[model samples]
Target chain A: MRIWHGLLIALGLGVAGGLYITAPAPLDAGFASDHTADTEAGALVFAAAGCASCHTAPDGASEGPQVLAGGHAFASDFGTFYAPNISPDPASGIGAWDLPTFARAVTKGVSPDGAHYYPAFPYASYQNMTDADVADLFAYMQTLPASAQPNQPHDVGFPFNIRRGLGLWKVAFMPDGYVTPAPDDPVLARGRYLAEGLAHCAECHTPRNAVGALLTDQWMAGAPNPSGKGRVPNITPAALDWSESDLIEYFTSGFTPDYDSAGGEMVEVIENLSQLPEADRAALAAYVAALPPIPSP
Target chain B: MKRIFGLSLATCALAAAAFAGSHANPALEGAVKARNAQMSVIAYHTGLLGGMAKGDVPYDAATAVAAAENLASAAAMKRAVLWIEGTEQGAVAGSRAKAEIWSDAAGFEEKAVALEAASSAMITAAGTDLDALRAAMADVGGSCGACHKAYRGPKN
Candidate 1:
């Protein structure tokens, strides 16, 4: 009985120690600290990342610059995660956060309060962003019109609602560096960075496991839409045989080889892609063309 | 009595769908045929413009002007015969139209008006220069997406 008590105490200590190590830690400022903000270049990052796709208020002003007021609901197997107000509003948005806080949240999934953000934010992919790009993006986002729209509380339930538990999830699932190998070709390398990091094509295109970690083995093979309505089409070289030019054209105009126009959420995706330079679209196509083909599931 | 009335109305719809499928009812199918023709005309002109926009075909002023004018004419076509009660996605074979076209008539008309507006703008832009044509193509694509996202269903 004394031995059993000793064993139980040891087990408890180990569990506590484990939790301590996995606690959310904000990233070191590193290169981001010395970098100067270039708001102009940040616009390129904003368009490539489709920051407006999930951040912009669907009902907000649409004509000129879109208001990134952030009430968009992202429904998932875990729960519906409403986007927080990211506008430059001092009170309601990220206006109070400095470049370091924004960088930590964007790249490390750690909040300003040092709490773990739910992976729904896609920092898993964003974690690969260059320090320069993060600084630039932060500078650009600060210039957008601010809205007083309050952030919506997420509808996550039960175990998922325990935000602290996500600390362990992150320790286990957070990948190191780019998921795909760095390529020698400069164009393919740019394509890989844009596709895997800023664009987060994997968030939708790559299937996830039961716990919502991306199935890296089946990269870009596509998956069931989180909405449960339809399948997101596979774009792996195995399934998508579109020429690089064809892919670029589709990105530019939303027209398929079949002459059918894009639909659903992809309409906005194409719109965002259309805003990019033609070279960027060409790079994305080149990156996709280089992916190891995974047969569609 | 309400259930009986609903059942008979459903039966009447099924009959219309059968004709829509087989083209036996010329009156109803004629409307479908006319709608399909207009869409084909739109597609043809769009392809012509797309080729020039992509530089697959050299951008000639006359061809660009003609294509844009044809697109505007097609967009402004009177189609009182199209979009009757029965020919929707699940109701008729090969029909990708959604029930929203009838359920929200004003929204449908708004999309048609938007298409006309877009094509009209395309006319002025198309013959100006390649850059202008490229700029116009984006809006035309957006207008197509706007309606399809609301009123079109997936392929069979």
Candidate 2:
């Protein structure tokens, strides 16, 4: 018995030593001469994501708050999840994360600590991003002034706190690889990337199951929010009220003839799209209007 | 207590009528400036009331009544401004303020009158019954939408 106990202790010590030695050190990837051009392009990608609206708290004002300061409340049928501070502060934010860890988190819904994050973070959409775009986003984040704001713990109840279960869930739901639009279909592909990944339209528009997973078979079908507002309408081709050009104009200017104008949550979407290059908006509209409608049951 | 509140509101309504009748001002430009400012406040109050109606926040019936009254009074005042020389040009920054407001002057007047009428109906509805309040609310939203469709910019 004494010999067995001694062996166990020796084995534990060896394992600990191996882990300590093999663990990566914090990232020190320096930005040298060539990275400058990439950084400028990265800035546009950052704007495309509209990262500022969620990160910044609206403290009783008309416009959204400062980028990366982190105080927006996202309300859903499940519960409200506050946005976290993503600024480059070493102690309170993503400053310590290495490039590989950031890429995994953004693309695979995994965190720096090797834990899976909730899809509420829109990793499903972001999973479609190209590696180079992901790299640029990281570079842009590095350029941001470090904010030392600590993250608030999520207000989820009971089993929701068991984040480890996300590992299994991710394996079932998340795609293993990033998507690339077909080379011959540039316009449609660009629209798909922007709508599925960056804009995250399905998060609000798609019907959800009891576990809060999206009902992919009914993607973009209209669904009601907890606030009891009008249901988010289907944008599929079967929505007979809208023409292709009408859809394009609505995205560009936020006016819908029957509904009057986009308000509440959609107002932010319009504001984001309004700032994009006109051609990008046109492409998005064209692709969306061309989608094969899930025929009425 | 309710009697005194009713009397005070009646007195204010009559005073608004007096103000509406006296069209004299610092001339066309000044009239337009004052009307635009007044209309902005009206629009802001509508937002506040709509927020309450949706229960996104808290509100009181008395406050709602007061807001509705002020908006009604402002809508009534627009006729004078519309008739004033170039007060027509002042509608632009208030966004969706159409140039056609001056050209189709009679149509614009009709919409403004409809809004004032809806506001008064809403105030009366709030004073008496919940059923009436619901009907009046629909009217108010419709009148705003109708006017916005015609004169306001598509960006609303």
Candidate 3:
């Protein structure tokens, strides 16, 4: 009877230990307090991040960027995940969320309720963002019109549906900072921030392991789109045989050198990119043009 | 008058036979080849104009105007017979046109009308100024996309 009692206590202790280990830690209070919100910079960050591409309703009838009512269904191997409403509606959106909660959600993939987020949110790439950018994005999002739309529940099944399991996946894949070292040049460094931090281009462009973690070693060599429709073309310097000017023009006009217009998911990305200043586009082109050429996979 | 009428009828019969034979096989194949060739020419002219717009090549007014004229003429050409019913997708190996084009005939015609309007506007704007050309570029690209999104397959 004593041995049975000891076993029960041990099992309870093990469960408690597991919960403690998986719990999400919010960002440092000092970081949130010190950061100031800038709406203008945030707007640029918002465009760079392509927030509307996923956050907007997938009905194909939603017009303009103002409505982020969020019912876009991202069907993946795990299951279909719907983007949650991030509009300023107090009851249905993130209006009640303080900057720290927003920051933690964007960067750490943690919810205000201390639950883990599915990586479909791309927080792994967003984790590289500076605290200032995240704050600015939060501020900018607040300026958009609010909607009263309720959040749609995701359709994940079985063990994959268990959100707690994602905490382990996060530990294995999420990096604490930039995936690669920042370049010495200020321009290239800013390009890295835009590309890796907010734009998260590598999320779509890089191939992934069987479990869907990005294969960082072959970064930006291109991969089959996660949505399983078509192959995303290789954009690494090795495979992209275009002049720097051609690259800039493609971003500005969506026309390839061969006269093929940008199609599929790229059309939306180019639309967002078109909103950016010419200088920002040029910076991106310069940075991509300078990447070490990787052979197409 | 009887001999003349008989000769005229014989000539009509021979012409109809030739037309039927062509429409049955080789002419249909010729149409697939001709339409593909015509599309290539359109792409070539557009590429030149696009190159100038991007400043990849020097924007010579003469070259720009010429390329724009070619594109406009190509877009306005009467090539309906080239896209006849039997030449889509599985009927021909290289044709990337989807079968929906036949079912959505009205939508396809609307897209063609849009391309014509855009191409006409492009001709008027092409050599006027860089700004005009840029504005026309968007319309031209948009019109192309409107059709391609619905009718064309992914490039291999």
Best by lDDT: 1
lDDT of 2 by residue, B29-90 (tens): 35456766765766665655554543444656787778778867876773542444333333
Interface RMSD of 2: 13.7
Q: Quality of candidate 3's docking, in CAPRI categories? A: acceptable
Rate residue A149 of model 2 by lDDT: 73
Question: What is the per-residue lDDT of model 2 for residues A1-297, given as tens digits with 9 covering 90 to 100?
Answer: 999999999999977765554333332244222343376666656666666657754552334433485767776665677888888888877899877778777777777775667777878777777667778888888887777877877777767666766655565565443233343578887887777777777777777777777677766766666455556767776663566555554564454533244555565566567567767777778667766686422
Off by over 4 Å in 1: A29-31, B1-33, B84-87, B102-107
In model 1, residue pairs whose N, Cα or C atoms come closer than 3 Å (at least 3 residues apart or on different chains), thus clashing, are: none
Please tell me what DockQ candidate 2 reaches.
Answer: 0.03
Interface RMSD, per-candidate values to 1 decimal = 1.5, 13.7, 1.9
- What RMSD value applies to candidate 2? 16.8
Q: For each predicted model, how many residue pairs clash, with residues at least 3 apart or on different chains?
A: 0, 2, 0
**Which stretches of candidate 3 lie above 4 Å from their native place?**
A1-17, A28-40, A62-66, B1-35, B76-91, B99-121, B131-139, B142-147
Ranking by DockQ: 1, 3, 2
lDDT of 1 at B113: 90
